[model samples]
Target: PVRPLWAAAATAPPAGAEWVWKATNDVLNDLYAVLRFEVQRGPLSRSPSAVSHANQVYPKLMPFLRWWKQQPDRPPLYYATLDVKGAFDSIPHQKLLEVIRPLLREEDGYLKCPYSRWCGKTGKARTVYGVVTKERFGDVEAVRERGRRLGHGRGSFAVFMDLVEYRLLSRTQLLALLTRHICSHV
Candidate 1:
């Protein structure tokens, strides 16, 4: 089970806020370790076979195939793509909290996220606390700085290029590309 960072810090209460910060670091490290393990285990397979068969084909055909097998007449093949502008940014904090609250284990004043693997042992899991005052795009500088600090390969320039490409293509253009190529064709 996950322990609240505040609780760990409070064990040596005289150490004050710094203890809390240390506990947070410990929790985050634990989470990162789990992520790293999963990535290394090949479970996050990004190969062409995995991506094409598992991600694209399965999601696209599963529901349609199920429905078609149950029906008497052959249904026409049709598809539609949806575009939600600023999908993550549009979510209200209270609503987001409502969705997340059920997954939390509450004790005293602090909350522990029991559902997240950050609760793992091995002294790797660490947690950080912060408030979201605005959308992620509104705090681009902080995001860039954190990414740079972490030495994550994808930098601000790469992110900007992706955003530019996304803006250049409409939903129709994306759908056209999807329909024009099969897994082998691509």
Candidate 2:
């Protein structure tokens, strides 16, 4: 059983008619604890926060630097890192839940999603919000690198890099650079 904790518009109509669903410890302490545990069992082995590519790439850098050293006149290089502040929030909740649905099929638990019980400031409001369950670490997802299990995933960062590199740098230009820097050195 959940309750609606709402606040009316501070300034004008629809300015901030916010509705917050409150899941008191009394209502969900035991059930959600179990819910969280059941969903997490034997799944999502990939760690989202690990810097795995650094391991593969750092070792290869030795070869690249050695190759670069052999070159007559090397141009300046540019490689920047992107740190998205709300990278976790950018992903849609429903989209991620859809991915997790299949994993839950084998789960033997039967718990109905709790919804808001009270009406909002609006007359007889009935905007029912669901339980809103998620992983203990809400942001962690399979899209992240399987750092614990290196070979498990191709890595989200790697896939994103591939897409960006494909669009920004032409194959011929990359191949020519690699060839001039690597093959000739070999």
Candidate 3:
């Protein structure tokens, strides 16, 4: 049997949140964990689309560099790196739950059926979220078009884009993203 949820406990005040909530993944439970592994025995791995890590770098970065170098009009290149700080935690609890609720045991196949003959009435979780839509909520060109419609000149948008590009390049990187041909093995 696997526990659906357990209140792990709250955190101390001032330093962290007054009561930080933690969700648990019960993937280690013996019965279903074994079944899950057996079902996936030696198959090709599938990655979660929304989750990414260091392993994705080599395949993308190396190919991109090769393509960029081969380009006839490629500009002076400066490698820039940016990582969203605490990105997952920055997601609203309601938004995260919104993504999860529809995929619960009854709705999604990966989640095991609760019981074979268990046809019972249960309330699906609900949370109210206030959403606001703004104009120009996308790419630089779209934003520039919005500004133009509101009568800001082309120069304004160009300057805005330049500032954005400047800030990205000037931000401190975790590792200096300089190109070097040091092929030493780890």
Candidate 4:
């Protein structure tokens, strides 16, 4: 959720766009706060046995578990874990657009994920300018190479995740349930 102040300042606001801008700003702030908190908390404990157990019980649970543990105070040693059902894919596209539109400067503005590649579908390659690069589109490998070249120093990854999460998690709530687990002694 790293917005370029210069970009926001340079943009000419549309008529009566204050409400939209304000809402987008709020969402961005929330997303930033959540991510910062998670990173500061660091990764959760994941012993080999525990991971093996999760893998055996639910094959797809490992990824989710890894993601969950990376969140701030996610394990809640003294509280039960809370899972937001269908967290992704529930976010409204319009809301995401509102948050991203101002940040885009070029004519295309938003990054275009062609329908062909929308669902991991592949077809002819296309090119799109993004916050990270300005060049012709090549194959997926080229795109990945460009990304690696850019690295993660400029907050591109954060912006990408923000856009993605905004698309998912429509109605979300956090509930704290007490648990007997404690790790202070460990």
Candidate 5:
């Protein structure tokens, strides 16, 4: 199961809060760690402008800004911070899974469905989890556009998943699980 950790929002109203999930005794934590390691070390980290940690931002951005200031005809430089209150909800789950599918395939031998032998409410061994719904919110670009507008230009299409309840056994089911989760949170 997952535990929730809440913190007061930095700039939102006093009643607002932000949260993240912390896994405890999760069977998939090892897989998650391995996936995170592989993803961080892979192409994602190779981007010249990619800065994962807060400390890296100052070290990375300051020099570039300084160099730009010294240039003959430098365009105006601007920096802005975003309020990512509902960031996770704005991303499409299907597209997110697709982006990570290739990476997931790379770990094929190491990736096995943890709920392969688990039973659902049907009282039978279930190979898949979650239900499919025809309820469509909007397109990926539309969702991203809303996120960009809400976040003041910065956006991402990454969706968080609960590995225990909605195992990655089937893409369709996973999408439904993620969609449901996002809808509830939003």
Candidate 6:
């Protein structure tokens, strides 16, 4: 079951307002980790200029800004800041799923253990354990090589659970809901 936990916002709102945080169960969190990994490795990979981590924002931009300002013929420089802290709340879940579904299905891929033990046959399994070492320490490179051997390792399914106030939905029912519409138009 998903739990809702509320924490104080950084700054209080002018009027009546509250913040609610949705915390997922362990199983859902694990599922999310896998989804996030695949989404990052495959579709929706971040651009080099993107500053996703708070600690990275200054490090990434400061040097560039310094060099640009040093340029004698530099044109007028401008920057913009957007407060997207609450942006997700404005996005509809169904629409969010709709946007994600195509990205997940873009490559029509599946999930397999990175070790390849579960999905691979004898003499067929791909293992990075022996291949990658502390000297190399290049798991990302190894994963890319694995992708060349395998196909694009993108996700084939997207799961969404919208929890109402006091309702609890079992994992089985959710799985059923996920596959329910597959054959309707087939």
TM-score of each: 0.19, 0.20, 0.21, 0.18, 0.35, 0.34
Using TM-score as the measure, name the better of candidate 3 and candidate 4: 3
Off by over 4 Å in 6: 1-27, 42-46, 61-88, 106-109, 112-186
| Minimal lDDT window, size 10, model 2 | 157-166
Report the number of clashing residue pairs per model. 11, 0, 0, 3, 0, 0
List the global CA lDDT of all models. 0.32, 0.33, 0.30, 0.30, 0.40, 0.39
**Local error of candidate 3 at residue 13 (angstroms):** 32
Q: Candidate 1's residue-wise lDDT over 57-136, tens digit each?
A: 67656765787778988868654321111112445534533433332222111211111113223323332322111223
- What alpha-carbon RMSD in Å does predicted model 2 have with respect to the real structure? 22.5
Candidate 5's error at 180, in angstroms? 8.6
CA deviation > 4 Å runs, candidate 4: 1-41, 45-57, 60-79, 82-119, 122-186
* Tens digit of per-residue lDDT, candidate 6, span 60-148: 77887888889999998865332122223455445544543443332323322233322322223332211222222334555445444
**lDDT rank, highest first?**
5, 6, 2, 1, 3, 4
Model 2 stretches with alpha carbons more than 4 Å out: 1-52, 85-186
lDDT of 5: 0.40
- Which scores greater on TM-score, model 2 or model 5? 5
TM-score of 3: 0.21
Best by TM-score: 5
Tens-place lDDT digits, model 5, residues 1-186? 323434333455445433433332233343443344345657857855556567789888777777778999988776632212222444565655455445543422322222232223333332321121122122434433333332231232222223444222333333344455545544
Candidate 4 residue lDDT tens string, 73-182: 76543322211111123444344334333322323211222111111133222222222112323344544443443334333221121223111111121010001111
After superposition on all C-alphas, the RMSD of every candidate to the true structure, in Å, is: 22.1, 22.5, 23.6, 18.9, 17.4, 16.3
- Candidate with better lDDT, 1 vs 5: 5
Tens digits of per-residue lDDT, candidate 2, 1-186, equal 322323343455455555544432223233333334334453432423222245755664566667777899999854532211111244444443343344333232332222222323333423221212233123323312221222223321121111121112222332334334322222
Q: Which one wins on lDDT?
A: 5
Q: Compose the digit string of candidate 3's lDDT tens values, residues 91-156.
A: 554453343332222211221111111112331221111111122223556444433333332322
